[model samples]
Target: MEKNLAQKYNHKDVEEGRYDEWVKKGYFTAGDKSKDPFTIVIPPPNVTGILHIGHAWDNTLQDIISRYKRMQGYDMLYLPGMDHAGIATQARVDARLKSEGISRYDIGREKFLERAWQWKEEYAATIRKQWAKLGNSLDYSRERFTMDEGFNDAVRHVFVTLYNEGLIYRGWRIINWDPEARTALSNIEVYYQDDPGKMYYFDYKVEETNEYFTVATTRPETMFGDVCVVVNPEDERFSHLVGKHAVNPANGEAIPIIADSYVDVEFGTGAMKCTPAHDPNDFAIAERHGLEKPICMNPDGTMNALSGEYEGMDRYECRDKLVERIKEEGNLIKIEDITHNVAHSERTHCVIEPYLSEQWFVKMKPLAEDVLKNQNDPDQRINFYPERFSRVFEQWLENIEDWCISRQLWWG
Candidate 1:
């Protein structure tokens, strides 16, 4: 007599049990190196998150390919892994510590990293359990983590080789800085949002005369760092003011008035205040005119001593107070409501500051050139899906900028 089958398959009863049995027998592991080989490397997931639907879907796709290869009698190696996640994980741990009324600086970098590792270990086990429920045949015995000693060693070797080949170097440049995290971030890590703010028009008085020229800015707080006032070389109204100097409103320091064709005649006031240490375009202008870069804010986004009486105030706080000071001094012409895109940190949600810092960068033009050349070869070695993506990809490579690689966080 045939036994009656259960009315319904119970996931709670069989899922973990079946996965445990498969792992016990090493069915997911590669054996018999002589067999035809098939391998799929799992995209490492950040340790800061748990098993989400997106990860379940991705692993399911990898499982299909792995299972198909196994059915064809090939030795399959589907390796699973997780990343230390660097800034993201560090930020998570920081939030946790803050909830407990402690700080990373309270315990020091070594102890802070110990907490991060503990977090990783606890979360990793939960991730493996969730992954097991999905029934993906990953090689559990060979699972890897990016911060593992073996992986770290491999990374170091690659870095040293690139450095020896002159592909890596350090230089001072404008970077997106997260004031809350107190670290420099890559361009991709910043989120830009359209924000409603005011554009301020202020007058810069000629050092030795009653003459004053109007300039406009979104961030009046950066006026403390202004080293020069720039006008278009052909702007007839201000051509006579070129090569003279103007007195800074925030401080009594005298700054040069330079003429450059890079100025936009139609923009507010037809004159631009050049804050070399605070803005990228201003930095370029300073470079062309050989002016000094005076940093006005600390890494934590507070005004520094260079900002005169406004030192120790928060950046936004200083902006409001500085505007009031300008009004009292009769240098403020007007304020206009404006909507502009402002960058914010993706992790901390604080506004990003255009900071001039020395950071390690990789020159990208050489690498982009190789990719562009290879894609256009007659042999057609690389192909693009949807065909239209080829043009977009080419344009991106053509205009690629130097990549910032260093992060100031304690985690990997």
Candidate 2:
């Protein structure tokens, strides 16, 4: 029977029920044992929020490839999943609690986890609905979540295997710390921004001598923890002062004046304070010179007992007070306004501190070596789109640092 053509296309009439029909017919399922298999695991979206334009675009691309493979007679498996998004989900949950005049601590761990699971289910359902609406040919029968029982078991097995292989270990090292979250963060989690700040110049009086060596720093509050002043070993300007002691202007403590090539002679006043616990470079120097790494700030970014009179004060507040005290003591050389790249927490937008901490890390160099070898093997190489990105991937692997995988969050 011939039917009259509609004046305008109605997308709802044309597309509605079409996806359900395909699903019921098992069109997206991969069950032919004799056929060649082609599979794509969708990059899981965070189960913390609703879908956005980006998710639509990404899923559309995956759908196109999956459909093409299916048409090519391959048993295509378009697997779907959602991520528990540890830090991101926790941050959102924390904000929601804050808006309610309550906190995760007030509700306690178990109750907080219940809330997180509720959030996860709500968003996961929304995500599934969005994916179905997009007409993606996903294998719903094989759907998974990152925190599912099988997935959790797989993750535990992998972690245990790595730990047994000596590729995973816990040790004291300098790491990015989110004070607001009270947790250690990986380097990639830190965002760098250029901020207007100051370069403070102060003097370290030579112990039992009439001379003083001018020192400069951006974080004067950490001076209370400084164990030594470092100068370039090749710099004749401070060569004679090596092995001598200098009185700390902030605490009246005698700290050694040491020399190491790591000190940049052109930077600041050709001298740098060794606050090992507060800085990564200083930590390395301390290890080499056998200096003490005293911590000056608590986990919450407040001055610790090591700061004496400034203890319990916020770090920035202590900085202002300590600078004022230094000026009054006649040790302030100068203060220059400047701009510098400061590390900040990507999630909380708070300033990140390079804190000494004990945390688990995955050794990356060995893994990188194996990956590079595989890339060079023609039979095993994974081709990169545009081809030029292969070099970028290789460069990243070559210079990759140890990855910190453990997060201090209740979820995931």
CA lDDT of each prediction against the hidden true structure: 0.89, 0.91
Q: Please report the candidate that would top TM-score against the real structure.
A: 1
Runs off by more than 4 Å, candidate 2: 1-6, 17-27, 32-36, 380-390
Clashing pairs for model 1 are none
At residue 108, what lDDT does model 2 achieve?
94
Clashing residue pairs found in predicted model 2:
none
Tens-digit lDDT track for model 1 on 281-391? 888888888889888999999999988788999999999999999899999999999999999999988999998999988888988899999997968546788889989
lDDT of 2 by residue, 1-412 (tens): 9999899999999999998999999999888988999999999999879989999999999999999999999999999988898888888888889999998989999999999998988889899889989999999999888888998899999999999999999988889988887788888899899999999999888986759889999999999889998999999999989989999999999988899999999999998889999899999999998888888899989999999999999999999999999999999989999999999988888999889888999999999999999999999987999999999999999999998777677777
RMSD of each: 1.6, 2.4
* TM-scores for every candidate against the unseen true structure: 0.96, 0.92
- lDDT of candidate 1 at residue 183, scale 0 to 100: 93
Q: Number of clashing residue pairs in every model?
A: 0, 0
Where does candidate 1 have its weakest 10-residue lDDT segment? 376-385
